[model samples]
Target: MSVLDTRCVNQLYLTLSNILSISESDLRQYVIDKKFELLDIAWSEIDIDEFFKTVKSNVNRLKGNIIESVTISHLSSRLEYECNKENIYNLYSALTGETKLRKYLSDVGIECIHESDVISVFFHGERIDWKQYEQTPVVLMLQKRLGVTSSGDKCINGFLFSGDIHKNMNVTHIARIPEFLENLLRILKVHEAIYFWERNAQPYEIIFKEKFSGIIYDGDDSLSLEDKNIKTIKHCISFLGRNLFNEWNQNDNPIIRLKDDNDVLADQIISSRNLKTNRIIFK
Candidate 1:
C-alpha cells in the first residue's frame, strides 16, 4: 500500500470545508458519504479505514489536477448550490503556489500600488490608475478583452473587474489577475513609447496644437514629423481600446485633454486607417 500524504489531504479537506462552509469534522463524513453514493456502494460494503486511505490518496492526486479532480467535483456539488468554477480554480492555484498578479508584476519589473478604490501600476516612472466602473463601454471592453463575465454584474467579481482576486478566499489571499496584468503591460509599453516621442520630438507641440487648431498640416511636408504624430495617435487609440484613455473626452481622462476642437482632425486621422477613434488622449 502507498503512503498517504497527510498534508495534502488536510489542505484539501480544509479547502473543501471553507468552500462548503462546513466544519472539517462534518465535512469528512459528508465526503465519505458522497463518495460512497457516487460509487453506488453501501458504507458497510467497504472497510472504513480502507475507504479513508483511498480518499487521502485521491487528494494527493489532486495536487496538480485540481480543476478536474473528481473529489473537488463531488465536494462542490450541491442540490441548491451552484459552484463558481473560477473561484475554485483560483483556490487551487493558491494551494499549489502558482504565480499570482502581484508576484507576476514584480517578476516583470512592474510595481503594484495598493490603493483602496483603484488599480494602480508604476511602470517606466509613471503611475497609472484604473478606476472601476460597473458596465460602461470601457469596462465592457476590458472585461471582454480579459474574458471576464460579460452581460451582467457578474463581471464585478472577476479579477479584471477589481484588479484583484475574488474577495472570498481570504485564507490564501493571493491576487490572480493574469489577463489584466498582461493587458496593462502592453498598454504601458505603448504609453512609454508615446512619452518617448513627447520628450524627443520638437514638432510634437506644434503638430498637437495645429492638429486641434483647425489648421490642417499633413505630415506630407515632413515625413519624420508625420510618422511621429501618426505613431503617437495610434498609441493613444490603443490606450482608448484598453480604457486607459477616456472615450468620452472627460476632463478626468488621465492621458490628455481631448475636446470638441480636435474631433474632426482626430476622426479624419483615425478614419484613414479604417479605425475609429473615441475622445481618448495623449497626456
Candidate 2:
C-alpha cells in the first residue's frame, strides 16, 4: 500500500524470480497486460489451497517444468520439490500484484536472504555484471568514496579495498591523488602498527587536516639592531607555526604525513586535545 511496501514487493519478485529460473521482467509485463484476469481472483483472501491452485496452473502453462506436479496434499510435502511452493507463491504474487505472499513470509519470520545460497544455486560464484545498475545511486556512492571511475579499477565490484584512495576531489582541491593515498595508507599503517605494538593501546580515532597557512614577518632594517626586534622575530615565528598547525587541523579531511622519532607530525606542533590522542591516528 505504501511506497516502501511497493518497493519491497518488487524486490521480492526479482529475488524470487532469480531463485526460480523465471524472467521477472516478462512476468511483470504479463501481469500488467492481463490485470483483468488477475483482479478477479481476490488475491488478498488467498489461503494455501487457493494460492497453490492458482499458481499451479500458471506455472504449468507458462514454463511447464517449473512446478512439475502441484498435487500438493501438505505444505510440508510441498517443500520437497526442487522449488518450494512458498517461493512459487512469492513469484506469483510478484506477477499478480498480491501482498499475501510477502505477508506469509513475514508471519513466519523468514525474511533474510543468504547470498551464498542464492549464488550456489543460481550463479555458482560467477561474476554478474548487472550493467544496468551502473547508473543507480548506490553505485555512485561507492565511486565517490572508493575513487572508482570505471569497472576495471582494482576495486572488487566498486567496493573499497586496501590501497584504494579517496580521489573524489579535483587536482586543484587535492593535488596528487596517488601520493595522497600513499601517505594516507602509510599514516594508517603506522597508527595500526603502533596500536598493536603497544600493550595497552586503546581504539584509535581519526584526525583530519583541512587547511595550512603561515604568517609573514616584516620589519625595518633599523629596528633589527635592537634586542626587542630580535625577540619579536622569534615570537612571530612561533606564532606562524601555531597558526599553520591550527589551520591544518581545522578541516575534516585527513592529513597524510610521515612521523618523526617521537611519532609526532615531524615538523608541526599540535595539542593532544585537538586530536584527542597523544599520537595522530586514522581509520
Which number leads on TM-score? 1
| Residue pairs whose backbone atoms clash in candidate 1 | 255-283
| Sequence-dependent TM-score of model 2 | 0.17
**lDDT by residue for model 1 over 1-283, one digit each (tens)?**
1111111246445644343334667646644554434244322233434433533433332222222111100011111121112222222122123334345455556664423322345664566434443455555454443334432111111110111111224311112212333245555554453333234322101011122212222222232433333322222222223332223221211122222122212212110100011112121
Task: Report the lDDT tens digits of candidate 2 across residue range 7-119.
Answer: 12354345333433457665354445434434433322223233224333233223312321100100101111121112222222221233442332333332322232121
Model 2 clashes, total count? 0
**Local error of candidate 1 at residue 100 (angstroms):** 5.0
Q: How far is 103's C-alpha from truth in model 1 (Å)?
A: 3.1
TM-score of each: 0.21, 0.17
The per-prediction CA RMSD against the true structure, in angstroms, equals: 27.5, 34.8
Candidate 2, lDDT over the whole model: 0.25
**Model 2 misplaced stretches (Cα beyond 4 Å):** 1-126, 132-134, 141-248, 252-283
Best by lDDT: 1
At residue 17, candidate 2 shows an lDDT of 39
